[model samples]
Target: MDTASRTAIVTGGSRGIGRAVAVRLAAAGQDVAVVYSSNAKEADAAVGEIEAAGARGIALQADVADEDTIAGAFDTVEQRLGPIDVVVNAAGIMALQPIRELDLAQLDRQLRTNVRGTFVTAKEAARRIRPGGAFVAFSTSVTRLHLPAYGAYAATKGAVEALIPILAKEMGDRDVTVNAVAPGPTATELFFEGKSQQVIDRIAGLSPMNRLGTPEDVAELVAFLAGPGRWINGQIVFANGGAA
Candidate 1:
């Protein structure tokens, strides 16, 4: 995969799996634009790492759910790095609450940030991505596993997975690919926060690997989808370590 002259935009690139994807793309010789919602410091750190990997890197701030913000972020990337060739929509939030206890506000937040954000980001990519480009969206294994508290979060990811096939069809004529990456229990801050050691162990044990997944593990798959795995489109690739 000769990505040396290509450019990629990774939303939520300031931390976790998003950060890992951004860095891995950079290491693969793609100029990277790291988009963050609020954390400039973390975004800058990601940019630094991308640059150290011998690729051009820039950090842009934008709320992924807002249409105007997403547009502005894409504009900045185009202006700074040229036409975007790859997009990884990794900006999302997880609000774990039973359906009965889920509030309208929390439900709206999850839908807006996760589902709407993925929609808006993919729309922009569909509009601007060059031929042979790819768009990757994030889903979660919880959508299939159906845990008790993850109703809302899983709903949002389910929406993402549903959109993949349609988006792939829409973008196919342009020689662009659309896909989703569903990760299982990973050792991200979002996954480990507020959990006891026993809880973490139990979660890890859910996977046949008997261990929590690493960001790099997920990122490697994302990198492959963005580069060599372009032929695999409109599908949800689960990097779950055989969990579920």
Candidate 2:
């Protein structure tokens, strides 16, 4: 992939899959800018790990749901890291409950962070990312599986998948690829919250592989799309360990 000197920005890089991707991209030889909405400590830690991976890295703060903030983040990355060749939008929130018991407030929050946040960042990437660049949006395999309580969250991701192809087309022979990664039952803190061991085991068993996925597992896919998987564009690659 020859990503040496290429640059990337990974939102939500403070923790979870985003953290893994930031470090992995650095390992692949791309300068990295780690973006966090808050949590300066974790953000710094992620950047530290990136530097440990032998790439120059910096940490920036931006609310992914805010257009101005996210745009400012892009500008900062460009000014500091060089022109961005890859953008991974991994900042998101998830709260599960049956549709009948859904919390309207949570739904609003999810839509803001998951859907609108992705849109704001993606809009910037579409305009700014260099030709032959890649934009990776995080979705959920639950959207296709249609799990019981994921209605609102799934709807927001469905919107993400819907927008990807259009954005890829908009790039229009520019050699940039816009796509989404739909992960199922990853072992991140966010995914583990509020779930009992019994429930977790059942979900893990749903995968033909008989276990949950790791953040690094998903990051490998993101790194490929970011660097080597240029022809695999305008699609969602599900990294669920054969689950769902």
lDDT of 1 by residue, 1-63 (tens): 688899999999999999999999999999999999899999999999999999999999998
lDDT (CA) for every model shown? 0.93, 0.92
Query: Which candidate comes out best when scored by lDDT?
Result: 1
Quality of model 1 by C-alpha lDDT: 0.93
Clashes of 2: 0
Worst 10-residue stretch by lDDT in candidate 1? 95-104
Query: Which residue ranges in model 1 land beyond 4 Å of their true spot?
Result: none
